[model samples]
Target: MTDRYAVFGQPIAHSQSPHIHATFGRQEGLALDYRAIEASPGEFLAALEAFAAEGGVGANITAPHKEAAFALCTTLTSRARRAGAVNTLLRKGDRWHGDTTDGIGLVRDLTDRHGLDLRGRRTLLIGAGGSARSVAPALLDAGILELVVVNRTPERADALIDAMGEPGRAITRYWEDIRELGDFELIINATSAGRDRAAEFKLPLSLVNSMTTAVDLNYGEAAIAFTAWARSAGCRNIVDGLGMLVEQAAESFLQWHAVRPQTEAVYTELRTQLAPLAGED
Candidate 1:
C-alpha cells in the first residue's frame, strides 16, 4: 500500500505541497500519494482526524490551521514548540508528532538558493502572526544584528517578541513609526494582508533601496502587491515565497521519509510552472 500524505489549509486550493512532495517522492523512488485538503476554520482537527483514520501517514499544515495542528499534536519538535505553531505532522504508532520547517525553509531559500548572507544584517519583519513567530527566532539564530518587528497591533508584536525570549536583538516598532526607523538590509512580509487585496497597509517605500532584499511570505497573486511595491521602491532583489514553500516541503518530506531530496530541480520546475501565473500578476 502506498503511503498517504496531504497538506491542510483554509484556502488550500493554491498549495504547492502535493506537487513538491510528489517530486520528492519520485526523486527518492518512494511509493507515496499526496493531496491538498481544504479544512475551514473550526474543522481542521476533524479533517485531520479523518485523514489519519483513512491512513494519512503525515500532513502539512498551513495558515490558520498551523496553530490548531500544534494544539492537536501529542508530541512536538522543539522548533514547533518554540514557534508555537506546527506546519508538519507525522504519525508514530498511534501518536501524532508536530514540527515546523518554515523558518529553516525561508533561511535555506535566502542563503542557499539566493546566495544572500543573513549574518549581521539588520532585518525588519512585518506582521506578528504565526508566520512571524515561526521565522523570527530562525532569523535571529542566523546571526542577524537586529530584528525589528512592525505590526498593526503593537501588543501582538510585543507578545511575539516575548515568546521569542525577548532577545535584546529583537524589538517591536509601531507600524506608523516605520519611516523613522529608516532602512533595513532585509525586510520580510509575514502578513496575509496582501492576499486580501488590501492596499491601504503600505510599507514605507523609503525603507527599500538598491541594496535591500525584500521578501514576501506569500506567492502568486498574494505576493504581487508587496513585490511590486518593493520594485517600485528600487529594490533590486524581491522574492516571493515559492522557493520557501518548496524548501519547507522538502524538510517535511525528510521528516516523514528520512530522506532529503535535492531541491534545486524541484525549485526550478516550480518556478517554471508559476511563471505564467507570476506574469499574470
Candidate 2:
C-alpha cells in the first residue's frame, strides 16, 4: 500500500487537506493516500493510533485537536512547543513527532503572497482557539507593532496572551471593548465565525481604516460571514484562508515528503472551483 496520510478533526468533511495533499503528491509524482477523518475530542487519540497502525505515516491536526495532538506527541519541534499547539504530525516507527506550520503559513500568505509588511502593523486577532494560538506568536515574531486578542471569553483571551509570554507586546480585551479599541492595521478572524450564526461575527466597523487588511482564517462557506462583514466595513484588502491553507499544507508536505510542491497552480485551481461558492457572501 502507498504511504497513508490524513487530516483529523471534528466536522472535517469540509476540509480541503485531502485535495491539497493529493495535488502536492501529483506534482511530486508520488503516490500517497491522504484523507479527512472526522474525530471528536474523545476519540481523537484512538483514531490517530488506529491510523498509525494502519500505515499512516503522517497527519495534519485541525481545530480542537491541535492542543490534544500536542499532548499526544512523543516529541515536538520547538515551534510546536512554543505555540502550545501542533497541526502537523509525523509517525516515525511508533513515535509521533509534532510541529506547527500555521504561523509560518499565515505570515507567508500575508506577506509573500499578499504583499503586506508586517512590521509596525497593529493587529487585532479575533479568536483565542487552537488556530489563534498557533498563529499568535508567529504574528508577533513577524514584527507587528502590537497584537490585541479578543474572544467572547475574556479569560481564554488572557490565557492565550499569557501563553505567548509577550506581556509587553500582546494584550487581551473583552469582546465588548472592541468599540473603544482604535483602528488596527490588520484584523484576523481565526474563529469558526461563519459556520454558525455567531454573534461574534457582528463586529464594529470602527476598527478598520482605509488601509486596513481583513483576513478570515477560514475559507469557503466557513469564511463567508466574516469576509462579508469585512467587505461591508470597507477594508482595503480582504483575504480568505485558501492561500494560507495552501501555504500551510505545503509546509506539512515538505515535512512528510522532504520536498516542496508548487502552490500557485493548486491555489488558483481551488480558488476557481470555490468561485461559485462566493455567491453565498
Candidate 3:
C-alpha cells in the first residue's frame, strides 16, 4: 500500500505542501499520497484521529494548529518540547511523535544555501508566537552572538525568554524597549501581522542597514509586509519564508522516510510559482 501523509492547517487551500511532497516522492521514487487538509479549530483532533485510522504515516501541522498538534502528541522531540509547538508528526504503533523542524530549516537555508554566517552575529527575532519560539533555540545553537526577541505583547516575549532559561544567550524586550536595542545583522519577522495584511507596525528602521538581512516567517502576501519594510529601509537582502517552508517540509520527509530529498529543485519551482505574488521580475 502506498503510504499516506498530509499537511493540516486552518486555511490549507493555499498550502504548497502537496506539491512539495509530490516532487520529493518523484525524486526518491517513493509511492505516496500527500494532500492539504483544512481543519477548523475544533476539527483538528478529529482530523488527526481519522487520518491515523486510515494509516496515514505522518503529517505536517501549520499555522493555528501547531500548538494544538503538540498537545495531541504522546511523544515529542526535544526541539518540539523546547518550542512548545509541533510542526511535524509521526505515527508509531500506538502513539504519535511531534517535532519542530522550522529552526533547522531556517538555519540550513540561511547558512548553507545563502552563505550567511549566523555565528557571532547579533540577531533580532520579531514575535513571541510559536514561529519565534520554535526557531529561537536553533538560532542560539547556531552560535549567534546574541538574540533579542521583541513582541507586541511584552509579556509573551518575557515568557519566551523565561522559558528559554538562560540557555547561554538570548534576551527578551518589550515593544517600548525596541529602540533601545542595538542594530542587528539579521532581523526575523515571526509575527502573524503580515499574514493578517497589516499595513504597518512599529518596525524599527534604525535597527537595519544595507548590510543587514531581513527575513519574514510568513510567506505569500504575509511575507511582503516585512520584506517591503526591509527594502524601504535600505536593507539590501530580504527573504520570505518560502524557502524555509520547503526546507521544513523536506525535514519532515526525512523524518518519515529517512531520505533527504533534494530541496533546491522544489524550492526553485515553488519560488517560480510564488514569484508573481512577490512581484519578482
lDDT rank order: 2, 1, 3
Native-vs-model 3 lDDT? 0.84
Best by lDDT: 2
lDDT winner between candidates 1 and 3: 1
Q: Give candidate 2 misplaced runs (Cα > 4 Å).
A: 197-200, 276-281
Arranged by TM-score, best first: 2, 1, 3
* Cand. 1 TM to true fold: 0.94
TM-score for candidate 2, please give it: 0.95
lDDT values for all models: 0.85, 0.89, 0.84
**Worst ten-residue run, lDDT, model 1?**
272-281
lDDT tens digits, residues 1-281, model 1?
45689999979998888888888888999868899999897888888888888998999989888777888889988878888888899998887999989999999998998888899788999998878888887898888889999999999899888877757889998988889998888999999988977653467777865668888899988987888788767775788899889888889989898888999998888788777332222
> 171-205, model 2: which lDDT tens digit per residue?
99888888999999999998986888553467888
Candidate 2 at residue 245, lDDT?
95
